[model samples]
Target chain A: MRQPIAQGRTQKLDSKRHASAQEILDAAATAFSERGYAATSIDDVADVLGCTKGRIYHYFRTKGDLFIGIHLQALEWALEAVGPTAERADLGPEEKLREMVHRHAMHLMNRASYMGPAQYQIEMNLASEGRNKDEQMARILKMRRQFEAYYATVVEEGIAAGAFRGTDANILVKAVLGTINWMHVWFRPGGPQDSTVERERTAAELAEFAVRGVVA
Target chain B: MRQPIAQGRTQKLDSKRHASAQEILDAAATAFSERGYAATSIDDVADVLGCTKGRIYHYFRTKGDLFIGIHLQALEWALEAVGPTAERADLGPEEKLREMVHRHAMHLMNRASYMGPAQYQIEMNLASEGRNKDEQMARILKMRRQFEAYYATVVEEGIAAGAFRGTDANILVKAVLGTINWMHVWFRPGGPQDSTVERERTAAELAEFAVRGVVA
Candidate 1:
């Protein structure tokens, strides 16, 4: 009876399930960030969420799974942030790269507390235990490369058009990424003197600088 | 007889001790970066060094201490690379920053494998245990600031001299740092197609791009 009733509202139920999973990933990211990954346990993640371990287990099969989930979500967020700008046909290469980098900087700061999960993620994927885990890790690396490749392609376009300086697209993209990614080291949103306006301003300046680096 | 003999060889022994400490740090940094810090055991570090855990213990009191040692060394490397340029009174801000960033990129590439310990450190300092540990961590944080401040001061000078764009000195410094420090992510020296000439050329280009982002 309960199964059929739940199945009746499949769309709403699926959305609710998505929300629950997001909540767990956020809690786990915070815990893993505060305590080093090795020191953090699934029980601690449950404690933060004020739920039972079984509840978390229902969503994630293991701690490693939760770690991978957080990384995948970050990649998803990265794609979501850059996809529109990357796809917009009207935008020039410079404008596309600027908007893409600007959005990326903001996204990074929004998840600043999870800088570890966001920035330090790719390296730790192989150390975890689970089946098909290697494939998942490979996907994470693939998405990362693809994320970088978006910037590279735009940069290549800029270089070919003589809008960007003549440099390797790969190196330029890494430098731009380095410039924006460094924000996680200092630009915490709730930190001292941080405000929404301030974050926007910082992101703008970062994008400007990143673009300036590439422009002819 | 032993005490007098040891006293006679003090300076030579001290330099040898320094070399041994450096060897251990390099080995430990490699192990920590390859295996996540949580997954790396001190024994693994010994395995890399081809020595016993006792020898490692003779230098570092614990794994966290070894972690701190690597970070401190990285900071030391950063300072060593930038200090001469930062202090040279003859060079203006433009030259100073260019040379400084160029040197920094090379230094980062040299230790590219320690990107985890170099870039992902400071956050984990608070999670460790020991007497005066907080003081040591604070010093690490302090040295890190002092390093960034080197660039900040230079940028401030450039701003004052009408040489740099009118931006927050702190933000400019961070952007520059992000540009060079990012080499560790993808610029391994011994990796495929890597060469000393290529490293120097990349550093020069990176410095040029970083400085372009700052010039008025």
Candidate 2:
């Protein structure tokens, strides 16, 4: 934010601070994605931005704050990507679910650096302590549940529409989302032939395959 | 070990040394899975085993060494579970893949503590350094490739038999394995309802779903 910005700050100053916070988050996400949460530090995040740790501390009070910010933003990006498709009234249930999975797969890959840290950090540290982190983690967890809800809603619609297999909806949703969540394991950003067409094809094909799994 | 005793003594204490190493790995794995590699320490692993640090260092030289040991053991267990089905001559390509996936999923959940750390550590630090680590890393990499090759062979056969969707085998294999690999992300072992019946059902259902995606 230049979050938690104090009360006397002007609107224009707040915007500049917000941009700085965004910049720090971007750098922190990369560091966390590469080294993971336990290994990454505020200094490393600062180094990623070619700035001193003070610049990071100017917006983030601690490493956990940066992580919380990254997790929040990652979920927000994911919700933005798949939310509209999940709610589209014109599409049938199967079509809607397929599009949601497709957008999610694409989002996971396209913004992988952003999502990578969130995936690694959130899973292991649900019980992490500290007052600010507790609140932030709760918000992050709620947002994550909302993201899962989007998928759950579409999967339920498909089942009720008689297009999806009559299996446990929780299991079905997790299995479908697994195809999207496991991308960071094998994704390498600096391939010699990392073409957009290849990436898009892979995402689309994966979406199709995932949907076919639950199709009755 | 013929085995090397924990503290670098290369002795003929085969069975006991092996047993102790196994126990240490079991304990270390639980710690690593729960806390992640960077957050976990040798002390934490020792605490899990209810032993002192000396006991841990006696079998393995360092935490990295312990991680390497657990990873090798996990892959060994995985290969044991699925390797036979993948090579069985009586089964068709689709049945073979289904069985392999089933066994792998079951193994992952059954030996979750063993496999969870492997999933997290191997994916992040493929390029981790050290002489012992470098050599061990290569063997681990080779075993992983062998695991993938099992799926690749069955998938190619499925495609040739007109039993599987004729998509790229690499992407297909990764997607299918993703269903198995994502278990560590969501699996919670201490639930009151964590019965064998439920675990078997999940593994079976997930295998069915995964294989369905590839079925033509």
Off by over 4 Å in 1: A1-15, A128-131, B1-16, B114-116, B128-131
Candidate 1, residues B1-216: lDDT per residue as tens digits? Answer: 112111122245567766787788889889877766777788888999899998877766667777777777777778898887899999999999999999988888777655556676557544545555776678777988888888998999999999999887778888998887766656655778789888888898899889999999
Recovered share of real interface contacts in candidate 1: 0.54
* Candidate 2 lDDT over residue span A19-103, tens digit each: 8877887888888788777766677787888989887777666666667777778888899999988779999887887788788
DockQ of 1: 0.54
RMSD of each: 4.6, 3.1
DockQ result, candidate 2:
0.57
True contacts kept of each: 0.54, 0.41
TM-score of 1: 0.90
lDDT values, one for every candidate: 0.78, 0.81
Whose lDDT is greatest here? Answer: 2
Q: List the residue pairs that clash in candidate 1.
A: none
Q: What would the per-residue lDDT of candidate 1 be over residues A141-198, giving only the tens digit for each residue?
A: 8988888878888999999999999877778888898998877666756788788888
